[model samples]
Target: MNWNRYIKDYQSYLRIERGLSKNTIENYGFDIERLCLFLEVNQIDVSPLKITDETLQQFIYEIAKEVNPRSQARIISGLKSFFNYLIFEDYRNDNPLELIESPKTGRKLPDTLSVEEIDSLIAVIDLSSNEGERNRAMIETLYGCGLRVSELITLKISDLFFEEGFIKITGKGNKERFVPIGKFAQRYIEIYQKEIRSNLVIKKGFEDTLFLNRRGSQLTRAMIFTIIKSLAEKVGLHKNISPHTLRHSFATHLLENGADLRSIQLMLGHESITTTEIYVHLDRSFLKEVMYSFHPRK
Candidate 1:
């Protein structure tokens, strides 16, 4: 019905106008599709244009029992964006969710690994295997550049500017930024390329893709997560970690070493420095140190 048409058109707007990633567009679509399913299953018979906030609140209340507050907040946010888009297209005069507020999930700090822990995780890789070198290189790059898993997978050989010591990253919304690469990461990547990766039969479309599966295709995000998970298990590292943990570690380590928020924001490809501040939490000791070192009164 109108649900399908509106979902399609709104997704197109997100893709073409907003330049959002495929995953983000799919999530938005899922949120709308879920609302439609709720209406259908309950015999509510409402369309996107005619749906009320009261009905949405009811749907949210039902789902809240099944999901956490963070997820509930995200669903509310997605629905709000969809309605806002409909209003922008002149389908409605006002947003249905204008008055609805998302539940506080609190500012959950990202998990980070310390330098020794990161080294231990990477060092446990069985280097004799072909994937071992590749894994080592990938982990080095992940922490070195503070790359999101998406950015890590899609990194290209051409993006390497080793002489300039910078690797170009295509972040969210396909926005490009250059992040510095240290010699430690560069060395491992070069070793992987020269010793391990080059031996594989390159697939047609993925010739320039940096990280690859054993089949020589571009690596998936799931595969990257699996690699990190397997390593964490092997090393007896108890913390629930992922590729993002390495990224958070990168930013946190930089801040601990006296890097400023604006610099970390640029390096992490964040649009706002506030996001960087939230992303890399500082301990009380570090806060005291910052004040002692830089404050005018100190």
Candidate 2:
């Protein structure tokens, strides 16, 4: 099959079968496209289905000069998934990336915000603006519920189960998890909806969407990053903070407060407990402090 047709099918598989996000699927497609471009440039006429492991390895080696080890490794991984999909569908007898090795790198932990830093960031929001109430509610839900930015923007009014004390969060791959909502978060959202949002004409497709931009459309990931970055600058906090920082902080703060890893894992919608265990590292000092204060053996 041609590279274009194969990539189209691969994207469909990622979306429908694997439940990957649009950005993730697009990245995978870009990796495959880059590989195809490299092969064409080098006068190699082999299609994706006919690509051999050796040729794939050569392509990776060529690209390694331009990218860092970590980024090169990610590209390799994305290519591997593309080939694996072909093998799974019986279009190929073998996987080209089966023997390819990912470069060895140290486990990089996600950055987190301190509770005081979070408060300081939120404190600077100019509540007098029309979108200020909405912004306040958005940040609270993001940090309080440990939501991915995608989950936060796509959040709907129907997702709020306030009477049940839970908000249903749609996570990666469209998986749904009911996370308990704090009263603080619920209160702000209510104020935004009833006081601010009720009067605006929400855009058609996003009418049920909880957070709307001034244009009444769903908030984009860029907007979320913009919101956080602007806030961080205003607060003069010298951390390279992102929306995910709030998420990591939510998990880390909970772990520091003596919440078990398993409970944090469930709330964060981690498919693997190992993913949640990274935050456990941040709580070590707190653990030792508790041991020294409360443990008789200490």
Candidate 3:
């Protein structure tokens, strides 16, 4: 089959069988399209099932010049997945990337904010503004629940099980997890709902959404980043921070405060304990503290 037909099938498989999120499917599609564009520009006539490893090596070589090692590695991985899918369907006997190796891109340690820094950032909010309480609640929930920006935006009011001290979060791959909600975040959310959101003329089909823009609709992920960036500037914070920074801070702070990685893994909805173990590197002191507190010889 041609590239278009193959990609369409792959997209369908990812959506229907794998249950990948739209953004993830788009990213995978982009990688395939880039390869197609490269082949077209070079006048190379080869289909996905017929493409050679040499051609793929050429594509990787081309992208290595344009992107960083991390991005280049990801593109290689995405391409590998596509070829593997072909093999799974018995369209190919071997993957073009079978012998290829991803670059040695080291793991990036996530940046985290100190507890004082978090408090200071929240303290600078202009409480008199119409969105002040809403913004405050959003940040609190982001940090308190260790939520990804996507999770924070898609959060629904009906998901809040305050009596159970949890809020249901739909994470990557459409998987759902119930994360604990601190009283600190719950209180601010309640205040915003009662004083601000309760009065909005909300648009159709977004009635269950927890956070709304001034236009009375769901907030975009970019808008959440803009709010956090503006707040950082207002507080004169020096670090380059994003919504994910709060998430990293949440995990790191939990590790430092005597919480186990397993617990943090569950709260952050990490599918792998290894993903949650990165916080162990953030604070070496936490290791010593854990050793002394729980070890028999300490």
Model 1, range 1-298, lDDT digits (tens) per residue?
A: 4689899999999999999999999999998888888888878877788776546756776677688889888988999999999999999976767645677773234568999999998899999999999999999999999998889999999999999999999987589999999999999999999998889998999999999989999998879999999999998989878887998899999999988889998998876554565568667789999999999999
Q: Against the unseen true structure, what C-alpha lDDT does each candidate score?
A: 0.87, 0.83, 0.86
Q: What TM-score does model 3 achieve against the real structure?
A: 0.66
- Which stretches of model 3 miss by more than 4 angstroms? 1-107, 279-282
TM-score of each: 0.67, 0.65, 0.66
Question: Candidate 1 — worst ten consecutive residues by lDDT sum?
Answer: 101-110
Candidate 3 lDDT score at position 158:
96
Q: Which candidate number maximizes lDDT?
A: 1
Q: Against the true structure, whose TM-score is highest?
A: 1
- State, as a TM-score between 0 and 1, how close model 1 is to the true structure: 0.67
Model 1, runs deviating above 4 Å: 1-106
Instruction: Report the Cα lDDT for residue 164, model 3.
Output: 95
Task: Tell me the number of clashing residue pairs for each predicted model.
Answer: 0, 0, 0
